[model samples]
Target: MRDWLIQLRKERKLTQQQIAEGAHIDRAYYAQIESGTRNPSMAVASQIASFLNINTFLFFPEHLSEPFTTALRNSPIIVAHCDLELRYTWMFNPHPDFNTDVIIGKRDDELDHNEGTIGLMKIKRKVIETKKPIRQYVSFPLSDGLITYDVFAQPIYNDGNQLIGVATVSTELLT
Candidate 1:
């Protein structure tokens, strides 16, 4: 839960104080929530969700999908898709062509072990574990320097609730 909040704040390029102020909550309270020391009440959650213009259930992403995909894609940030192993699934930027060597194919490597894809890989597991989406990814540089990505994802499952894969997005934050 705390991880999700932190990710969401960072993805929005916002800070705890900012969200707390905007959501009309105490900064200390929000910090506790982000630090895993507290949980927001239903009313507080609703207020925060409304202020963020995000669906309230976003706190738990089993509640995310088709209805939110459009909203998520239209976000100023990039959006993407990936298999459970964290391979380079697909992206939505419309700029970085997948056919280019800039990306890879199935069975390329675990995202965490890959040079540019590590951070994304790390967070993907969190999404899978929590069955929720995260917003921010700890950005790290690859050996190539300019090829790094800051990514996050929403885990997708089947009607049977079987873990399918993830829908992701990222940006070359360093560039």
Candidate 2:
């Protein structure tokens, strides 16, 4: 991903500083994001993507017609899918302490036991109810430390445009 961004910037005859300025972010911070050492907030990522003339989802990358779990397992970003009932169905690159066998059929509150999990559940519920997309900067506590993510959640739909569930892709942030 860093290499792709570097190459694209080069093709456009732009420098990291130029992009940072265009996005109105600190150059050093933007450099860290481009190098994958730090993840940007959704607003920052969107600004950068707009400056680069690319879709925001390009940062996460997903394949069509593949199972959500499979597509996310190979993704550069952390991803998860939930059923219509808001029970977790699949996860990729989940928190280190998470056990798939235990969490597969559970809600965040049932397994995570954290206040942040409650907030995340609310966000998921909103997406499911509204059938709209949302991007937020969120942080949660883990066993070892706190982690922040540029969280992107959206309602999933079938071929008939019927709501199926919700899916989320989040890139972890350094700070």
Candidate 3:
């Protein structure tokens, strides 16, 4: 989730500081959201969505059937997606290093940037096995000096409605 938020923000070329200012939030606090340590208020999510020109529901897709990549360009939270093979395919957020040079076609699971999020992997496996949408919280530490964030997860499917992967969105709780 945190990863996805990072991906979304980067797609727009917006820095964390820029998103913070746009959402009327502190840059540090927004960093926490990207790091997978905090849970943001719904109001915060809405503020971010509005600022990014995306529907808030895309950030928390309860019935995720279509890919929300186009809508995520301006998303404030980091988002990520993994395929049925349990390989990570996407992550969106504001972290500078996460640009196309790092991700895109890479395997997210073996990537060092994953930051050791074991819980998220387990939940994703369960979702794939059950063929149902799931929501949960996952967190990861950012070495750049920011608290973790509470990530939100759901399932994404292909055109035939076959469970394909999982999508996540992360938000930071303002401390």
Candidate 4:
């Protein structure tokens, strides 16, 4: 079942009929979607998501395919998602100095207060504000030395095309 959808609906005190009316869909169809029995098309998903004030991507399957995830696991690349506030939401293949436990729910500035961390935060903020993708280099100081990474950041949006967060992919540059 789409537990998240149910939870959101309950939280908003909205019934399936209410949601269906708002999205201009049939109540039964909405029920099927909530029960995970029927997948909605992109247009239908967008309408429902807009009415529900959530991201349309939530109705889709996994964002990354299995093959891509498998390759990413063995690659020396970092992938991360952050909320609009720049707090880390999810991450994979973090640098040696940091782990998921240390990063999740924390902003870059919270983890380290240096020029590099500050720069990274600025870049993320720009993406959120401009709703655009960016590619740049960022560096961080560690016990060993300074590490540079080629970073790409993109703004994530909800069904209404509202900026919600940022997603980043970074590769450590070997000197």
Candidate 5:
């Protein structure tokens, strides 16, 4: 979501400040939306989408299949999916330490800017670029200390067999 917004905004050679101004929103507030800290309301989403010259539906994951959504919801593992741009489109049962509400519409880099995050981002990139599945151990810092998980990521394809995104499941958390 944010990735698409950012990409579209960049394609138009617009800055966050500019878009914010055009949308009649505070730059700081707009930054929050771009950072996935806060979600925009439908009206706000519409406004932003219009300002960016993109469809508002891009902000929603309505295109995802119901069976996939159900699988994610029913999975006990922390399941998530991100577009080819690495922006999260869907997530379920995220880490307890994270705010699930803020996970969607975020890029891997937006979530954190640490070495751990960078490593994870690299792995995600590889999965997308190679169109392969990967299973690895990942550790990231938490407020208390650190947590680790076994992460499995695979590329997602549409009906035409075109890669669209990456799906991941992270479980077996170790503190």
Candidate 6:
């Protein structure tokens, strides 16, 4: 049984039915969650956490560690997460000329207002709207020169299953 979940529900004076309704799920499903007979998806967990006034991360295991960091550090591909507004939220192994400081919280247009950045933004917007993944070759004009990359972008969701933004992996294509 999920003792912690049960304890929290009791403390709030909420029954399984109430939580299920609040989370837009069936009571039996919620009951299964409480009984530990079923595992909740990220979206369901987020809803339950919201009802309990807690962070959704509580439902997930903390597995990100040194290995993850090390791999990302050594990776050649650039990885980034952006908000719905297309502003960068997190990035790893960015281009040689650009650092985290220049990327985070900034949109592509903010970094470089050109045809290339415009095209990139359009691709990201399409992914966000369609809730799908897209892969294309994109070019960016930098101070050094124009660099082309194979970019893959997909919709990113919050724990609530809400589409929050897009995550991207970009690898420079050598001629």
- Highest lDDT scorer: 4
Judge candidate 6 at residue 89 and give its lDDT: 62
Candidate numbers, best lDDT first, in rank order: 4, 6, 2, 5, 3, 1
Candidate 1 C-alpha lDDT tens digits along 52-74: 54434544433457666666554
lDDT for each candidate structure: 0.60, 0.75, 0.64, 0.82, 0.73, 0.79
143: Cα error in model 2, Å: 1.5
Model 3 agreement with the true structure over 1-175: per-residue lDDT tens digits: 4666787688769999999999999999888877767666778877776575444444454334445555655555677776666554555553443563355434445444455356667777887787666666555555654445566677887669877677777665444
Sorted by TM-score (best first), the order is: 4, 6, 5, 2, 3, 1
Off by over 4 Å in 2: 1-76
What candidate 3 gets wrong by more than 4 Å, as runs, is 1-76, 113-116
C-alpha TM-score for every candidate: 0.40, 0.56, 0.48, 0.61, 0.57, 0.60
lDDT of 6 by residue, 45-128 (tens): 888865654445445533346676677765658888787889776677787777664565568998779887898899999998
Residue runs of model 4 more than 4 Å from their true location after superposition: 1-65
lDDT of 4 at 149: 87
Q: In candidate 5, what are the lDDT values of residues 1-175, reduced to their tens digit?
A: 3665665566558899999999888999898888778888888877886565433555566556788777765454787778777877666666666664465556767878776677777778999989899998887786767777688999988669988788888875645
Answer with 1 or 5, whichever has the higher TM-score: 5
lDDT computed for candidate 6 = 0.79
**Residue 53 displacement in candidate 3 (angstroms):** 28
Better of 3 and 4 by lDDT: 4
Q: List the residue pairs that clash in candidate 6.
A: none
**Displacement of the residue 16 alpha carbon in candidate 5, Å:** 18
Better of 2 and 6 by lDDT: 6
Model 1, poorest ten-residue lDDT window? 96-105
